[model samples]
Target: MTSIAHSAAVSAALRDGKPVVALESTIITHGMPWPQNVETARKVEAAVRAGGAEPATIAVLDGVIHAGLEDSQLEAMGKATGFLKLSRADLGYAVATRKNGSTTVAATMIAADRAGIRVFATGGIGGVHRGVEKTYDISADLQELARTPVCVVCAGAKAILDLPKTLETLETLGVPVVGYGSDEFPAFWSRRSGLAAPMRLDDPADIAALIRARAELRLDGGVLVGNPIPLADEIAANEINPAIEAAVDEADAMGISGKALTPFLLSRMLDLTQGRSLIANIALVENNARLAAKIAAAL
Candidate 1:
């Protein structure tokens, strides 16, 4: 295992067998504008703490993997620029090369599992892109879920991708998708993706039980909890789908693909929706954090 630097709080929690929720650093470095990104990260951590769990925001800095970040580290990461958007493929490369980088869902999961953390919270997991046939641009996140044991709590696949294909791929991977109080899988900013969730478990304790059951059965993958955005905070599918379509089309036209595609589409969404998308994103991320904390406690 790679050497990991644990923050004081995370070390204490792990030593004491306390609940802890893993958070990703890309949400701070690549997901939003600086101050809000830092502020939202703090709020999400607070939400975890409020739910009776410690927060472990994972990142890689100067050839070291950090299982938890301190306040100053969080601020620096938020303000830093030109960091790699790391996933499974390049996580080790960044560490080996001593480069600063932000961990995406896949990379975060790998790090969390290495640190003995079993739960994570994030805004959404990436999945099959719209043009998976031509581009084959699937995100590493799905594969991570298939092989890693850390449970992930997210709003769902990002709205910019093909939700149907994403769900199909998860099914093929044998990763359980559980809805947290909804039969339908959430579409990131929206409460409904119009796709029925494969399994529904309303209570966090029940979700924890499901995780335990999987462990007992010796399942190879993690569980995904599709947590919907709050009603007041959600941008209805009707209102947001058009913007998503437009942004995806524009990316295709502009020749943006692979790692650049999501950030491009998301930045375009901020412009097209006049920042409503960002507001919803922050809300959903915090919401996932709180729920993840509860699930961690139950576990």
Candidate 2:
């Protein structure tokens, strides 16, 4: 069996019964260039701390699932190359083979649950890819959300996905999709996805109560909190939609599907939007982290 290694901070937080937020590591290894990735990661961690929660940035290093990373470990992870983009399927394989891997939402949720952490903050969650009817390339993140008990706080599904279909799938899977202070679902870089949220809640304490209510009702899955990006930081939907379409088109033409698809589309959009997408991504991630901390505290 693969062992879990918790950083000192996370262990201390757990022992003391303090709020702790889980963070995914793929943003460091596959989301951006080295220095910026590391810098954004540190900023997100700081945001979580500022909200009075310890940040547990989860990843797989040398076969061990780490609930939190030390500063040096984070730095090394950012600079490392050839890391696997691990989800539920490959996470165990990476560990069995002693390979270094960065956890996606699915894998991170699993690790967070194992570590007894409840709240996870991320920029976006993977969902039904565009052309899913043809390609059938749904993300493992959706299924993870259906079964894992962690509460996921994200800006929303990435704009490149089929938002309507993703929401439909979540509904089918019985996952609660709650918008934080908005009537509409968020579209990652943008604040609106053009779909009404199934549920809405404004306060972190209310969300915490919802989580408890789910447990009380014996529901066996996670809750997704769609927190919109700050108005000042959002890339307007009108401005971002075209770029997303173009990038998706390019990926389809190039036959880039599966795990490689999201990263490819994101990188292409960065070039297409002249780096604005990355800026918005960093902002939204920090925003989500702060919200997750508050929810954790409320719980």
Q: What is the C-alpha RMSD of each candidate to the true structure, in Å?
A: 0.7, 0.7
Candidate 2 residue-wise lDDT, 167-214, digit = tens: 999999999999999999999999988899999999999999999999
lDDT of 1: 0.95
Q: What are the per-model numbers of colliding residue pairs?
A: 0, 0
CA lDDT scores, all candidates in order = 0.95, 0.95
- Cα lDDT for residue 137, candidate 2: 93
Clashing pairs in 2: none
Task: List candidate 2 segments past 4 Å from native.
Answer: none
